[model samples]
Target: MKTTSYISRQVENLKPSGIRRFFDLAAQMDDVISLGVGEPDFVTPWNFIEQSFHALEQGYTSYTENAGMIELREEISNYLSGSFQLDYDPNEQLVVTVGASQAIDLALRTVVEPGDEVIVVEPSFVAYVPIVSLAGGTPVTIQTKAEDDFKLKPEQVKEAITPKTKAIMLCNPNNPTGTFLNKEELQQLAKVIEKNDLLVLSDEIYAELTYDDNYTSFPSIEKMKERTILISGFSKAFAMTGWRLGYAAGPADIIAAMVKIHQYTMMCAPTMAQHAALEAMKNGRQSVQEMTESYKQRRNFIVSSLNEIGLSCPNPGGAFYAFPSIKETGLSSAEFAEQLLQEEQVAVVPGEVFGSGGEGYVRCSYATSIKQLDEAMERMKRFVEKRL
Candidate 1:
């Protein structure tokens, strides 16, 4: 008997994430120093972890509401309001998710229909394109320029619009580039979104880690709030990536649709994680501040060190990653990463994994300790001198 080939067309056509490929290679090598993954190197605050155990001791391990525990939603609502001055009714406009990853997936699934176009700014987190495609939307990438610090320009957004365009995905305080969208920048893009009446999915996982001015939220734009789905989580800011807890806030109709999808897809986010996140939100500002400061120091160190070695990397204004141009080395981003890993045992991500705008650069995350960073810098210096 012969077995028939079986797989969904969507699953068959999907490409694995480029970042994951490099991570797998790095993981198998001994003495390799990785500055690849975007997660914070800090541990979750003691208070939050203790609260999770306390909840378990109290037998609060059952399933939560599909949206999440009401108390957690309330805490998130208050946190957003107090922190970003964005108003969201917890009861009507929020749904807890496994992570910002799941929230992004659910938001696209809820809003995009087959063949609809979803505009993604390039040099973004790798998850957006596949997630949009899995949700049956076409992923249309809009390349942002380094001269603009990788910020999305209004003209670019306007040019990407089409009758079939259903939504625009904004990754402010962006991952690979560490570029942030300010109020003025957001307002300019908002005008195009409002004019086209398109939906916005704002992934703000690194909002609290900004080094420059205060981070702006999409909901803060009065015109765009009604159609925007704001996705954030405790992962990056609270160092709770393993906890898999996040939430989305938006208009009632949008949130309701996402909740329905969440109900069928995941039922609910982890109960203990939700409980722990509530505690974090109520009392984790200081932990966030400490981590942000540490990242700032690392950021300054790495940017300066890279420049000293003849690689020009602009000072990142937000997030913990620094994207440095590798043009002088005469290698593509992938070749440079591979050669550095083999020669110096230092691992960094190739920027092209993030999309077209990242070709001549590589992403170096500053989330590691100063000791590790110093060592990595030395290795990087040797590698650059040898190559250049």
Candidate 2:
């Protein structure tokens, strides 16, 4: 018998999430203003919680269908069509998953055979590359530069394409950076996608949190729906991070493949969450708008404060993050994040953990309260003034 370690090489080599590390560190300390975790500060709305409680009282605790309840699927179908002009058959084209993260995993596993090259744009979420690797695919990166506003250009996609290229993974109103590609930009990228015959995994979890009308759903483009797997969830816009609910809509055949894997691995999303999500889809627009407006206010304040504090930050169009360059502090992203946490008791994530093009910057999520943000900014200013 061959002697080898019990743990698979793939699992063993995976890096711990940098975001989680800082979040945990902050959790252990007192009086730490946390801008490290990318979660909403608002609690899940009471109405949604009430719906879940009602479901439980009605004894609806059993597992749902592997693809989720038919009613929830229909609501999801209607949402995409009405919001993004993307149509998908509820029965054959959509499958609710544990979260958008799980949907991303299932989508990659369904289509990416071993040796397939998945083009990943960075600085992106830390999970994208690792998930691609776990699905037995290679992650080819396209580095979006800060000077260019971190937009993914068509020529960059064209240059990254290879014969083995399977798909491109994108996070619209992207995490860590909060940079979103507008309609014109998507049109240009669509040209390259059509030319290369590639697929797209569009993660639009923050779709409803746009600061303006600049956000464009990827699959809404001409003929792009057929080649795209649209992943979204209630975590961001609806303040349902703990609910563990998300869904994917794509081509029927592709969805079926994903459902097959999901059935064996996850079976179905939480029945209670599915019920709450149904309520959210039916009557949660007002709440969403209110939360979005608050985030916009925080975004403005944070960007203005970061600039005054000697950190150069871009105005993020959407999502609740402020990606500020800490280069002026004469320290790397990790160094800045560490010293800030130690000295000022402000927790922000080091940009390097998000992959290439992330160095020299830190991702500070403005998803917390205005008062916390104000104090964190003051502490950051004190820290940076000493070095500058």
Candidate 3:
């Protein structure tokens, strides 16, 4: 008897995350120095962790409200108002999610109809395209140029719009490239969006990590708030990735739809995480400042070292990555990264993983310690010297 083909076409067609391939490869090699991961290397703040443990010890492990614990939601509302001058009625406009990843997934699932177009900026986090695709939307990639420091220009956004365009996915202080979209730049896109009547899926998970400029929120622009779904989490800023706590704020109707999806799909975010996040909202600012300062130092060191080694890296204004052009090395980004990992035992992500505009570049994360960064830089220097 012949066996049936079990895999769904969607699952078969989906590309595995390019970022994970290098991680799997590096795991087998001894002495591999990985600058490939985008996560903060810092441990979660002690007070936050302790709070979480205390909650669990007190048997506060039941499921939370579908919208999350009321106290946590209130804290999130206040935090957003204080940080970005954006306000949302937490009781009506918020849904607690498993992570920012889940928040993005829920947003797309909530709004996108089949064959809808979702505009994603290229050289972005790898998940955006796949998430849109899985939600039955076509992922329309808009390539942002390195010469513009990878900012998504208004003209490009305008050209990508179509009647089928359901939403625009904006990742400010973007991953891989670390390019930030300030208020002035965001206003341009906001005008186009307003004109087109398109929805905005604004992923501001890295909003608090900006180095040189005040980070801007998409919903803060006049007339854009009602049309925007803001997704953020305690992960990056408060070192709470493992807590799996994130929230989305938007128009009540949209958030209500997302809450339904979240209720059925996840039931709720972990209850202990929700309580700990409330504590973090009250006390995590000092820890955030300390971690940000460390990342700033590492960012400075890696950018300078890469430039000194003949890689043309623009100093990123935010996030913990430095994207450097590797054209002078006479190798494609993938080949360069592979050869470097094999020869120098250093691992960095090739820019192509981030999509089309990312070719001929590599993304190095500075979330690790200075000592590790110093060693990685020396390894990179030796590798480039031989090639150049």
Candidate 4:
């Protein structure tokens, strides 16, 4: 049989991750200061790690309930309610997922049918469109503009809707750009969503990293809880990326559908990770605050530095990324990223990898230490100057 014939067209046609090629190239280089990665650089708090060790020592190594351990789920419920005013029943409205990435996949897979359309905001995380396609839905994209500070407007949401539209995917404090929506902004969009009778796959993985008090949980909007699948996790805020633990909470029926699919594929999130996340919910506030402060400082510095270097970046209100325009250099996003890497020993992700509306820019993660960021900025300035 021909290889093409044996493979599913969807799997075969799926493009390789645009971010991976940059990472692969960086890995082969020496002494490269990388701003390409999106994860928090902070080590997982020792207390949380110790708690996981305790769980393992106590022989809690077996698989958890497919939805995850009750204790962890309860903690998640309490935490979300306390922090974001999102009330969920641990038993029926929550599922401990392998990661927020898995939660996004589960949410899409649960609701997206062959002809359904998901309206995806552009310059989003790389996974959203592909996951929508894999879930058998079409992704209708709306490109947010820099002139509007990259905020998706209520009008755009209203315009994107059609009879077949099933949902809208939102990454508040969006990746690559780090643009966050305030409560009022989300409410305006919420009105449109409510009118359209559409579901919401709101990815708030970076929710805890917002620099202001304005970050609003989408499901917490009036009348939105029933139609929203709130996806989040411990990876970004708690520095628990390796734990691979996340969860989704929404209407009980939607959550049940996700859990059913999760049960077959993952069985359960890692037990030790579930235990660690329990501690994270209970006592990880200090670590999160400290890291958020550190990130704030780095965010301030990087945005200022990029502007001074003439990259013209908006001061992102949340997350650790700085998406700065490289258009002045008169090179494509890919060209600027590749040439910068070859010229200066720095690695940053080209913005084009993110989605439409990301060209002429590059995403530099400030998740690293200030010392490294200072050096990377200097290197980038030198490279950009030569190009100009």
lDDT sort, best first: 4, 2, 1, 3
- Each model's lDDT: 0.92, 0.93, 0.92, 0.93
Q: Backbone clashes per model, in order?
A: 0, 0, 0, 0
The local lDDT score (0 to 100) that residue 22 gets in candidate 3 is 79
Give the residue spans of candidate 3 off by over 4 A: 1-4
TM-score of each: 0.98, 0.98, 0.98, 0.98
Kindly provide the TM-score of model 4 when superposed on the true structure, using C-alpha atoms: 0.98
Model 2 ranges with Cα > 4 A deviation: 1-4
Q: How many clashes in candidate 1?
A: 0
**Tens-digit per-residue lDDT, 1-388, candidate 4:** 5677888899888998889898888889899999998899999999999999999999999998999999989999999999999889999999999999999999999999999999999998999999999999999999998889889999988889999999999999999899999999999999999999999999999999999666789999999999999999999999999999999999999999999999999999999999999999989999999999999999999999999999999899998899999999999999888888988979999988988699988999999999999999999989988877
- In the order shown, the candidates' Cα RMSDs to the true structure are 1.1, 1.7, 1.1, 1.0
lDDT (Cα, 0-100) at 256 in candidate 4: 93
3 versus 4: better lDDT goes to? 4
Q: Output the TM-score of candidate 3.
A: 0.98
Residues 1-388, candidate 3: write the lDDT tens digits.
5444677789779999887897788888999888987789988888888898999999998988898998889989999999999999989998888989999999999999898999999989999999999999999999999888999998999999888998999998899899988889999889999999999999999899998888889999999999999999988888888888888999999999999998888899989888889889999999999999989888989999999999999989888899999999999999999999999999999999999899999999998989999999999999999989
lDDT of 2: 0.93
